[model samples]
Target: MSEFKMEHKNPEGLFVSKAFSQAITVSGKAKTIYIGGQNATNSKGELIGAGDLELQTKQALNNIATILASENASFANLVKLNIYLLSGCDPRIGYKAFQEVAGLLENPPLVTVLFVSEFARPACLLEIDGIAVIEDKD
Candidate 1:
């Protein structure tokens, strides 16, 4: 068993979403992992999807998953996610794509979706960044 604990909550007054948690309280010793913004790009830095929001969203989520694995963690370890969508993009597409992969997580993390005019890469449709906490081994 692990000493680290996390309490996820979605109060009655708040909008409860299957996609994400409203809040999370972390306790005990843990290691915090800060993941950088990831877009729909392959390991070779080439865009995976062009002019396709759903595909882009999935690729970005896959990138995040890869990062989490590198830290000896998974989606369940995520505490928060900041999602940036192109200003004119449809968020529903992104949400659906996320759900396809996020269904594996028993406790999804708190999420914030924002509309941005542009990203560092012009071809990028969306970007995702995450923060995760893992039980401290050291």
Candidate 2:
């Protein structure tokens, strides 16, 4: 596992715990893996969380994690993350979910959570996509 740590240069920053700099930069040669939008459902095609942003966010992360694992990637290896959210929500609601999701990762990845008018199916409060790069370890 890579030694992933959060940087806190601006201690008085507004979003203190919610800000970070990505660990992996252009300096290293890493393998790339792109994970598609993952929602709060599992392989069984059932919704893990209903009508709840926090629960759904957790499930979405788990769903994304599975995809990453299949490709030999971990949150620590993530270079970018894209979060897609259903329309009928306060932006703060999505931000809250995102804050939790970021905390779950070993290190915060470059992220942009977009609020969309609709998703593949409704009732999904959040969907997450990930791009990761792991060193060759050679």
Give me the candidate number with maximum TM-score. Answer: 1
- Report lDDT per candidate: 0.90, 0.69
Where does candidate 1 have its weakest 10-residue lDDT segment?
98-107
Q: Count the backbone clashes (under 3 Å) in each candidate.
A: 0, 0
- Report the Cα lDDT for residue 67, model 1: 89
lDDT of 1 by residue, 1-138 (tens): 788999999988998877889999999989999999999999998899899999999999999989899989988899999999999999989989988976646788999999999988999999999899999999
- TM for every model, in the order presented, reads 0.94, 0.71
Clashing pairs in 1: none
* lDDT for position 87 in model 2: 70
**Model 2: how large is the Cα RMSD against the reference?**
4.5
Give the Å error, residue 113, model 1.
0.6
After best superposition, candidate 2 residue 104: deviation in angstroms?
5.5
